[model samples]
Target: MSLKIEIHSFSYKKGGIPKDNSGNGGGFAFDCRGILNPGRVEEYKTQTGCDIGVQDYLETKTEMPKFLELVKSITSINIENYLDRGFENLQINFGCTGGQHRSVYAAEKTAEFIREKYPQATVFLQHDEQPQLNSSLINDR
Candidate 1:
């Protein structure tokens, strides 16, 4: 039995909290603004979170690992319960000023973590600003 998790990354300035059609109404939202931004650096300014250097900067310079740990703890509990109850959708959103760096990083990491931690679950990742890397572990709804 596979559970479904929908992870989204967006810019707060461009899109507000994504509307939940999963009957849950709302879901978790994490702001990436507090983390040190690679966007401010000249070399990393044009790069997205997918870049190795940007990912390294976030991992080495910011508290992203600790933050993801907290996220994992919360989502693990919720995902287990959701699976038990046969729930279909769990939405987790990450937001930042530009949605290109910090939020994108967080969302990608979270999706990867969820897929790794819950192999039976289906994870869909959507990046609003960078749709090129957007992917789905399951077919579109």
Candidate 2:
């Protein structure tokens, strides 16, 4: 069986978490507002986490690594169980004030991590604020 991880990044102040058809909550929501924001700096204000400079700043200046580790540990367990139960969909969300900086970075990295760690699963990544970049999918299997 193949598992699918749908990762989303959005602005908390804008719409909060995305709701399902039944109006129930969906997935994990990691608030990245507390993390060091590169957006506050003028140099990185327009830049997204996809930039090397922004990525370096976040990895070095913030506790993002530690946060990601915890995310991985928790999600890994759930993923294993989901796979065992033949579940097809899993959604994880990352949110920040702007949804352009920390949340985007975290969502991207988490999707990458999940894809690499679970080669049998497929990972889908989306940035709500920056739809121009288009969504990406990792077919690990």
Candidate 3:
């Protein structure tokens, strides 16, 4: 099946501090920091050595474990019903207080999770209120 997913990659301006209790699969809190300030490219590269945000927040456990679970649940639902599915399209949305900071970072991490678990599937990133890329995705033409 032609699988497709939409994953929004955001920065720090819209999404406020992310919370863990957003779903029923409640788990321990962990900060999956997705910080990559281009201003300090050299330093950041030296600190982590990996370009992907996944390597940056190499913490013991992620604070937003529920986010990961949420994604897993989606995949599980589809896989359970094998041939029944035609084209799998999942939009794992991550909404912090705004749409930046933790939410954006979490979204990135979530994308990685989905890719690893559900390979050979399409993924897309959609930020609701991205202050960085202001291209007017909300306007009437």
Candidate 4:
């Protein structure tokens, strides 16, 4: 068989990073805000928690007009590497203020994007709201 792509969606919540919350080193701990949009990330500084504009970090952000460019640069490279090497599965994250709104929407959109971009690959989303990581894509890991 060739390769098959899967799309897993999870609600993303804004936070520093996900820990098992334990100091062990088992779960995920990636900071999506700062990583996806570097210089533009300061927009969150004044806000105490979860600014909705984060979704538009791409459509907005005048100075760094390439929000998707930055996101893809950080994520796609890693995704492609796994695929090129013939990995069976991969999981990716897209975090927003709350798992309810922007993050959820973006996660769905991202899953769609990945499915279309890499038809042969399996794309999955693990938003912050997920009680556990990779509830669906867990097997891939």
What is candidate 4's CA lDDT for residue 96?
Answer: 46
Computed on alpha carbons, the lDDT of every model, listed in order, comes to 0.85, 0.83, 0.45, 0.45
Which portions of model 1 show Cα errors greater than 4 Å? 136-141
Q: What lDDT, from 0 to 1, does candidate 2 have?
A: 0.83
Model 1 clash pairs are none
lDDT digits (tens) for residues 25-93 of candidate 1: 878998888889899999999999989999999999999888888888988898999888988888999
Over the stretch 1-141, how does candidate 4's per-residue lDDT look in tens digits? 333333222233335344332233332222234334422357554321124574455345432235435645666775677678765544444454444333344455555666667666654455456444335552243
Estimate TM-scores for all models.
0.91, 0.90, 0.47, 0.47
What is candidate 3's lDDT per residue for 32-91, written digit by digit as tens?
343233224444333221234423442223444554565567655753353256555444
RMSD of every candidate to native, in Å, equals: 2.5, 2.4, 9.3, 8.1
The count of residue-pair clashes in candidate 1 stands at 0
Model 3 regions more than 4 Å off: 9-62, 79-84, 131-141
Q: Is candidate 1 or candidate 2 better by TM-score?
A: 1
Cα RMSD of predicted structure 1: 2.5
Candidate 1 global TM-score: 0.91
User: Could you tally the backbone clashes for each prediction?
Assistant: 0, 0, 15, 4
In model 4, the runs with Cα more than 4 Å from the true position are 1-65, 125-141
